[model samples]
Target: MATADPSNSSSAFAQLTNILLAKGGYESDEAWKFVEDLFKNIDGKVLSSSSSVYKSVADGEMVVGLSYEDPCVTLEKDGAPVNVVYPSEGTVYLPANAGIIKNAKHMDNAKKFIDYLQSQDCQDNLGLTTTNRPVLKDVQIGDIMKPISEIKTLKEDSEYVIAHKDDIVDHYKEIYTSISSEK
Candidate 1:
């Protein structure tokens, strides 16, 4: 997971939490209420998102975000395995792609950068350091990160990126503005 910048808009945090909860079968209103309640009196910014929340919860912090309610129930009691579950609700998948501009002067440099990024050494480093999934077929991620083979459900029915890119961007911008105004 990326290190969240404290300066980032709260709306980004809110939207991230909202998406996770909605996907995890929690009602949107209820999820927002939970967020509000969780951070009601806190002064320092709390990490708010499924990934960060899961990490925080795993580390024994009072974090709240989307997950299988059962996972939370178990973690709150049994305290074993410690996995974060994304519920099988309305999950939206966002697949990323890399492309170059139609007319680029630094085409060679771009290709070199992409080639370097796809190298085995780079992939291995990325796997150990961040949430980046290796795109190269031959790159072995080893035990540092969760293997793609282990994530059967995600492979089976991953959501494609939003079809209406412009609309989605506009909607998120509006949401960010609305939430930031309250801060």
Candidate 2:
């Protein structure tokens, strides 16, 4: 199995950490220890980038990878003999976001664009064009990707994650570096 390096891919690291935290009963101290212990014990690879993690799996360099859903689905569609599974304990859903810049010259156009992003046509089109799941229910998100409703998702404490992000990243890096050095 492969996991992303936290220094280069904070979002992926955070998502993975969030799931670990949830599975460990949201206990920060114990979760941190568990994460460190897993890294120390598992004969796993730590890829420098999240893309590398998925690519390693698809290319048969690694058997399992912790990566975001969309690319894993894409790899499966490309017939890489990969399987995508949402952790039954719980998984994190990191939805892509769009926001209009404040004081934009074309306020009306910006609003229209936001509306278009949420439109049924766009939502449905995303299902066909990309692995990004549609926000609207009863919309197709391709055959390989599971519907959000079907997945057991854990609610992340965003504020806490945000507040401790830097510390968390540093701690993870420390553990990773220590293990790599020992090897």
Candidate 3:
């Protein structure tokens, strides 16, 4: 299995943590224990970036990866043999939000940008040109990208994630370091 190094990609690391916690029914306190056992038991590869994880899988260097969905969809659309699985235990979907800041220097431009961002034309472009799952329900996505409604999403506990994020990063680093040293 492959994963992004925690220090290099905290967002990817957070996603992986969400998967591990949900999949094994492990609490925040026991995250370290579970992560340690995972790396120790599995043939794990910690890459520098999320892209590296996908590249490893694509090159057949790794059988599976705890990576993002966008690249997988992109790869599949390009005819690469890849199976994107949303863990049955549940996985979090990262939502992108856009808003204009208060007292902006260019209020008119900001409004225009926000309007353009919300427009169906832009949303459709996001869905078609990129692997981004469009927020607009009416926008059609690429053939390989699964609709958000089709995914079994995990109800994120924002407070818990925010509170434990630092601890998760620290423990992951320690565990990864220890495992790397042992090898």
Candidate 4:
């Protein structure tokens, strides 16, 4: 198993617990306990994703990676022998949003691209072609891609990020160092 510091890695499960804790009104100690268990037993690399965590996994430098579903799907599609698994205890779904830059050099092109992405055709085909879960009604995803509604997602706590960002960062560092030190 491999783990990466959550601050710099989108794949890291740093805020994974917030979903569960958020509904309980930011009960962080419990959340920390849950998060700590994820890394407490890892026996692989403690590195940043900056060094290409996916590539390392492909090269067999790591046996398992705690990551979001997209890259894993892409890697497998590109011929890397890997499997995707959800945490047995359930996991969080962190949605990444996108926006067009106002100062982009190709403003018109950006607008067009965004518009195209929002189109019916794109929405209908999104699930099959991309890792993103489509927002449109009645779109079908692959059997491997579980429905978000069926997923056990931690409820989002709006204030948790603002209030606990530092604490979360510290805990992430502590977990990584503690695990790495064991090696």
Candidate 5:
């Protein structure tokens, strides 16, 4: 029952739909219908963060998580009684992006910084500090972190996600909020 701010691009529904679409490749329409059912099923169960979801689990407020991998890793490192499940149904991959501003006064510097973020050292440092997987190939994951290669992932289309994120967010607002309002 872990949730994000509906407007949080990090927790966009596009990835969910992309994942479900992968899972239901032969019947994408049904995949979308199932996603709607999923949101309804999860309506009242939403928790604000991975920690909140972990607290809910600890307090017996919920039985499972539908959240990111980071908190579970953090909790496990702290030795709280919890486990992370990379769903057998397959997980989703959505990378955080770093972009340079258009027409910036220091375009080269901006470009340099973005490039550094993509570099092996910076990415590995990011993994160590944040306990999330680094994008650079074969960087070791933190001990509690799930090795990225092991998870059967639904690789989302960056182009499509970039193009249609707003629509997806709006659709989430429409359906999920409508459920809450009705209830």
Candidate 6:
């Protein structure tokens, strides 16, 4: 297991929730409620950084049951062999999506921009630099992202969970207030 500092409340809870939502397909509002409930049950303060969480865990500063991701974790970073867990409970997978704005003045340019982004060269660059899983079938990006074989993708026919965008944002605002009041 990777390590994190429990006292480092900078990014722990938020990053955990973000990753969980990405894997669980929770709508933003549902995600907010889930996180709120999660924090309400935990004793420690939530930090904003995973690095802090990792350190805290590593140093035995805190204990939590969660998983994390970092593309840079490799033998070079002295990272231990850890498998990315896919809970039987379920997860959400957010593919890198791109689209042109309907009313943009540079419609043609926007199309070209999207095309460029999806090109093999750009995909390779993104794979090399980030955790982005390329959608293009032809792009042979290796070493930069988890191999396609290793990924546990959501079923193509799975039902989508849509969150009320406005409600999600507003709920998070209240959750933040609740968190602050507890301090």
Per-residue lDDT for 57-167 in model 4, tens only? 777988876666777777776778777666554565555466887799999999899888777888768887776678665777766566766766564554666587667
Highest lDDT, which number?
2
| Each prediction's TM-score versus the true structure | 0.42, 0.88, 0.82, 0.70, 0.70, 0.48
Model 5 bad stretches (over 4 Å)? 1-9, 12-15, 25-27, 43-51, 101-116, 166-183
Predicted candidate 1, C-alpha RMSD: 9.0
| lDDT for residue 67 in candidate 5, whole number 0-100 | 57
The runs of at least 3 residues in candidate 4 whose Cα sits more than 4 Å from the true structure, single-residue gaps closed, are: 13-26, 43-45, 100-115, 142-144, 178-183
Instruction: State each model's C-alpha RMSD to the native.
Output: 9.0, 2.1, 2.6, 3.9, 3.8, 6.9
> Candidate 2's C-alpha lDDT?
0.77
Model 1: per-residue lDDT, tens digit, 97-163? 6776867799998888878877788877765655456666556653434455544333212222224
Ten-residue region with minimum lDDT total, candidate 6: 156-165
**Residue lDDT tens for model 6, 92-137:** 3445588988899999899999999988899877667655556676
Worst 10 residues of 2 by lDDT: 19-28
What lDDT does candidate 4 reach at residue 89? 47
Q: Candidate 3's error at 28, in angstroms?
A: 4.1
Better of 2 and 3 by TM-score: 2
| Local distance difference test, each candidate | 0.46, 0.77, 0.76, 0.64, 0.66, 0.51
Where model 2 places Cα greater than 4 Å from the true spot, the runs are 25-27, 43-45
**What TM-score number comes out for model 2?**
0.88
Best by TM-score: 2
Evaluate residue 63 in candidate 3 and report its C-alpha lDDT on the 0 to 100 scale: 88
Instruction: List, residue by residue over 50-118, the lDDT tens digit for candidate 3.
Output: 898888888889888878887887887787877888877677876679998999999999999999998
Against the hidden true structure, what lDDT does model 5 obtain?
0.66
